[model samples]
Target: MAYQPPVRDHLFLLRDVLEIDRYSNLPAFADASMDVVEQIITEAAKFTGEVLAPLNSVGDKHGCTWNPDFTVTPPPGFKEAYKQLCEGGWTGLGSDPAYGGQGLPHVVNLSFSEMSSSANMAFSMYPGLAHGAYSAIHTGGTDEQKQTYLPKMVTGEWTGTMNLTEPQCGTDLGMLRTKAVPQADGSYRITGQKIWISAGEHDMSDNIVHLVLARIEGAPAGVKGISLFIVPKFFPNADGSVGARNEGVKCVGLEEKMGIHGNATCVMQYEDAVGYLIGEENSGLKLMFVMMNEARLGVGLQGVAQGEAAYQAARDFAKDRLQGRSLTGPKNPDGPADPIIVHPDVRRMLLDSRAVIEGGRAFLFWTALHGDLMHQHPDEAVRQKAGDYMGLLTPVLKGYLTDKGFKACVDGMQVHGGSGFTEHFPASQYLRDCRIALIYEGTNGIQALDLVGRKLASSGGRAVMSWFAEIDAFVEANSADEKLKPFIEGLAGAKAQQQDATMWLMQNGLANPDNAGAASTDYMHLFGLTGLAYMWALMAKVSLAKIAAGDTDPFYENKLVVGRYYLERVLPETAAHLAKLKTGSATMMALPAEAF
Candidate 1:
């Protein structure tokens, strides 16, 4: 099945819901009028759907091959397709203009990435990781370092990867054993085996810039001793040309994975590989998080993108696949049986996926817009609030969206029944590919903990308070509008439950650490529900105004229907999460280790 980019939905979002032109004063937005934005997104859609979508199945079937020369070869058409991807210059859509990039808004770049990721997830990781690396260097690198690396990375001449996980450590940086010894020339010799390094080594780009995490020699113990290094596959000469190969770094092995096999997931061995320090020693985690945070957002989008592809597959299948008759009456009476679309149960599954796919996309854009505003906004207070919201919402965005997005994938497959289970269809690939998003860039469980353990209390809880206030203001302002009463009421109700849950945690969680740990996941889901409610409200508000003006577009009408379905069906999950979470850890922690 060909992947169709949701260009229309995004245009509605940028034009109607977000009113992006309202922020035209921002440097990037100044050039991003709706006309230009539409053109860029439309072109991106063509490239992704035409060039990239075709390779998704090929990438899955052939995967990548590890060779005797320590090089991993991409699937049959991957090399050529990657060349076209670079030639098209989609990788640097959101990069700084100073570095040979178009310098579009981050959300616009994210929208482009959503299509590419949907079409070819495995291949998209090549540029996705590079953009994350570009961001890390752009933010923390020295002027000389920036001039050396950013331009080519932005141009896709060089791809990048982040080396964080090792044999024994996944999320705990304190357990990392990678070592970096300082040389007389001020460069560090990085010696470590990094595992699960995506885009670690491939034959597509001229070079691979690795952002490695390692401990400096004789430094303090645990994570305090950690540092980030810039390790390239080949050294760059004084004139910015590719120089001698770095023999110390090699892709010693590749992991045969569940999905996304087209991209190389390598066991990268760095034995005395020359590395330049990023920022300062022991401050590496801070700098690396710039990429980590960005990657988490990107990963969340991966979940949504995969869900979208799956939903498209499932919806089409339900409409065409002959199944049992509808309970009410056979809509396709002339046929042997009604299409699955006539069955209410099948409708339930499709609606569930649609609610999440659309709501999740809006949540992603809302959070990303705050990211842009955090940097580009004029008012200090606005920037501070935007920054605070980014920190607080990132974990929820990651944890909740991926969890729901993966569920959407599962439902998508269920709608297909047996056909979805086989390799002949794309559902299996989407399910497998999306599964990893939950585990990488920090697990969903960890995201929940971060939300409850850290983010909730940051800035003396001002961020959460601000979120509450924002919702309250919206509800109050819209209560008088009768047509939007259901949306406003649902949103207000969800917000109240969220507030109550927060107060419960503050009251009980401090007394027992287990309470916080046990309630974390549920609370995270609750947070996600409220966030989506807020998003749906914003979308509904705009859609309602459009309809009131006598605009008869069915798009506006369908938006209200989906928004209502979400409020009635999906938003109610918050109550269950709240009820379950309030039970605390007593029963959950009662079982002894020996009992298991």
Candidate 2:
């Protein structure tokens, strides 16, 4: 089935639910009226569906080729699609106007991101990694560095990659051995290898800018001593034009992966590569996190995007594929058998996918709004609070969304039965592509640890407190409305369980950190369920209001049904997570290392 962008859903969320026009006071939203948003969404949908969707299968089938000259070529049509993406100015949709970006809101860019990802995930990564690199430079690069690279990157003439992993280290960056030796010209000579580097090399751009993390000689021995460097494939001259090749950088090999074969996962070798420092010395990890945080959110969006794509494929198939008759009776009497959608079990899978996908969409957009506020709000206190909220929620978004999104893909495949297991169907590819999201951008385990270890107590728990207060306010405001009682009560219960889990962690983890580690993953899921429940409640309230205003659109009605389904079937998982979390580290750590 061809991919279709969720344009209507985006329009509903931006205009009806988010009411983004209310933020006109912010300069970025000054021109982001509903009409403008609709236009952008429509154009984005057209571009992704018409231009990129057809290449999804082509990419998976042909994959990328590694040349003997240490260069890589993307799957056929990927370069052309990427060129179209650049020509459309989609790369810098949310970048700074000081460069060549359109200066739009991040949320707006997020809408297009979902469509692009759904249309073609492998193709999407090329630009997605570039955006992450662009953000790092825009945030931490010196003015001269920005003047040198930002414009070209913003214009899509050059692409970017993040280099952090090594052969021996994945999550444990402290063990990384990549080295950067300082030189007399104020540049550094980098020498080491980075593995699992996405968009590490390709023939689609004029140059590749690598944001590499390496330790300088004589610097500390651990993560604290690590520094970030701008290692370009080809060094640019004083006039901002491409110069001689940086002889030190080479794509030694490409990873033959289970999915996303279109984009190269390169094993990059740096042999005395010329590199420029970004930000303060010994503060590389801190600066790299700015990009990591952005990438985490984007990865979270990837989770939802894959789920959206899978759900659409499943829903369409269910409506047309003939199968056994409905359990109750024959719905399509004239046909050989009824469409599988008539079965309760089939509906269950579709609804499950739908609930998670839609709820995740709302949660992501809400978080994106906070990100916007965190960066652009005039009020210092608001910006700080927004930043705190973002810090607290980032892990939840990354960990929970990816886990559930992958499950949704599996469920989508199940809807296709034997066909889904074969290469002919897209379900298998969706499942394979989404599996990686759970592992990258800091594995979901690391995200769970970040949530439980750091973000939970951040700013003395002000962020969690603020999140609790907001949910409470929403429940209290809508509790009296009979139509919203189910959603309100469900959300309130989830929030209470989440709060209890937080208290349990604070009390138990203070005495033994193992308790926190044991319960981290469950706590992240609990927190995520509550977050989605809160989003559903808000969406339900909006749907109810729209319905009461005499609008009879099935769109609003379907939203109400889906929101109720989420509250009824999905939100209750928080209780189980909460219960498991309360068990602490006893049974979990009982087994010895060799027992497994």
Q: Judge candidate 2 at residue 93 and give its lDDT.
A: 90
The window of 10 residues in a row where model 2 has the poorest summed lDDT is: 563-572
Query: Over 4 Å off in model 1, which ranges?
Result: none
Candidates in order, TM-scores: namely: 0.99, 0.99
**Number of residue pairs clashing in candidate 2, backbone atoms closer than 3 angstroms, sequence gap of 3 or more or interchain:** 0
Q: Report how far residue 159 has shifted in candidate 2, in Å.
A: 0.6
Indicate which candidate wins on lDDT: 2
Lowest summed lDDT over 10 consecutive residues: which window, candidate 1? 85-94
Per-model lDDT = 0.92, 0.93
Q: lDDT at 515 for candidate 2?
A: 98
lDDT of 1 by residue, 127-238 (tens): 9999899999999899999999999999899999999999999999999999999999999999989999999999999999999999998989988888999999999988
Deviation (Å) of 586 in candidate 2: 0.6
User: How many clashing pairs in candidate 1?
Assistant: 0
Q: Give the deviation of candidate 2 from the true structure as CA RMSD.
A: 0.8
